[model samples]
Target: MNRRLPTKTIALLLAAALLTGCGAFSNDNRVDPELSLEQAKQTAMAMELELAEMIPDENVASVDQSQTGVLLSCDDKRGYQWTGGMNIVVQGDLDPAALVDAIIDRYSTQELYTAKSSPTPDGGPGAHVIGQHGAGYLVNQSPDRTAIEILSFSPCFVLPEGTSPRGNF
Candidate 1:
């Protein structure tokens, strides 16, 4: 004769699965509020400068963040229309060539989409990190229908130590 599990066991198993999928069992459920445009820019710049000083570098040349709001047109009323974003760029200095390789190596394991070594007009080695994310299209004209994209590009001589790396979301 075949022996089947009790009804209570099946019910408990289903409940546990549902909780796991819904993230209800997560330890931390807090979400940080969104930052204003000006705040975001300032915070990003400070972080960039901090990173620049950590590595072995002479000085940070420039640190800037760009932000943009865009509205695209779609063929249908519910068609896909994505908003564009701003790009951030940062430049700095380095004495020994090996330090450049070290920074790139660490960044390779981060949230960076693309990292490449390029040349600057002033005869300096420029390293860049680029990332892109789709905000998705809206199905209805909801009040919260805007998407903000943050891009940071800081080529620092020295990177910050003991400081966790952060990027735009």
Candidate 2:
């Protein structure tokens, strides 16, 4: 016997599948209504700067910053995650391994921060650490090892009704 589902039923099933598969129901990307998009970007930038300061001041010659907005997932039609990165150029030698250890030590006393150094595929030192409100950073080294980047991300949030995600979508 040939059996076919009704069009309405098929549409409902498709919607359910998309919502589940696209992480619409996942709380991993928790939305904070109180966090505006601008506030999220600021949080990310400030955290990145704080993490960068973990390195010695004299060693840091200069810094550059970049920020971007990203959607949580395919299901996230309106929600956005603010990502920020600060590139630090060192005047003297800056040891990433030592810095990672220093960060771990610094955050140990802080209740909101937890830090750990991860393993890198290239056998170089890797770093991943978390701070308050799911704010975190991944330290990336330049291939030439002359500059270090503090790649940071903010918690997922939606822009308030009055705000736009950069005046573009």
Candidate 3:
């Protein structure tokens, strides 16, 4: 006697094998969204410290942490009198769309700034706000919906005459 597996069972088995092989359910990139605002601030500070290590020559002028976000300002050692600053905003437990919309609404009302919204790679909402100068603001949620980061860079900062800014990106 000969027996054959059912089509539905075969299909389901194949799908399971494929998914396991592809690691489609992996959470390697997932972040814990349960972090409190203070924890997020500490994370931002840790990031700043990492950046400092990356660019040791730059001097950190100030760091400000608040309920909204953390702001870090640095001086480029070139003596060009330019200030480089970055702001990081962390949003926890809010829907991605609502977070992005709030960021857009907050910046849209400001003068000399242009706000544009786009879809993030993970299907989340993102916004980019540009000021009259070279300053820029970026707001986006993580792929895992763990948190949102809003980054802003100052316009006064610029590379020295001979240095290339391309590497900064």
lDDT of 3: 0.37
lDDT of 3 by residue, 1-169 (tens): 1122233423333243233321111222122334332443444444334322321122222323222322222233421111122322233334557656765676678775555675554456766655432334445544444434434333323234565333222
TM-score of 2: 0.69
lDDT of 2 by residue, 1-169 (tens): 2122233432333343233321223334556668876787788777778887777888877777664534332125556666545667776877878877777677756876666665343455646666544455566454446666665557556655555556322
What is candidate 2's local distance difference test score? 0.57
Candidate 3: where is the Cα deviation over 4 Å?
1-92, 156-169
* Tens-digit lDDT string for candidate 1 (1-169): 2122223422332233233321112222221234233343344344334334444333333323233322221222321112212212223433323434544455546663333442222233333332222111101001121211122321111112443223322
Error in Å for residue 96 of model 2: 1.2
Pairs in steric clash, model 2: none
Pairs with backbone N, CA or C atoms under 3 Å apart (clashes), candidate 1: 54-159, 55-158, 55-159, 90-153
Cα TM-score per model: 0.33, 0.69, 0.40
Please rank every candidate by lDDT, starting with the best.
2, 3, 1
- Which whole-number lDDT from 0 to 100 does residue 61 have in model 1? 34
Span of 10 residues, lowest total lDDT, candidate 1: 134-143
Error of 2 at 22 (Å): 17
RMSD of each: 23.2, 14.1, 20.2
Please give the lDDT score at residue 102 for candidate 1: 46
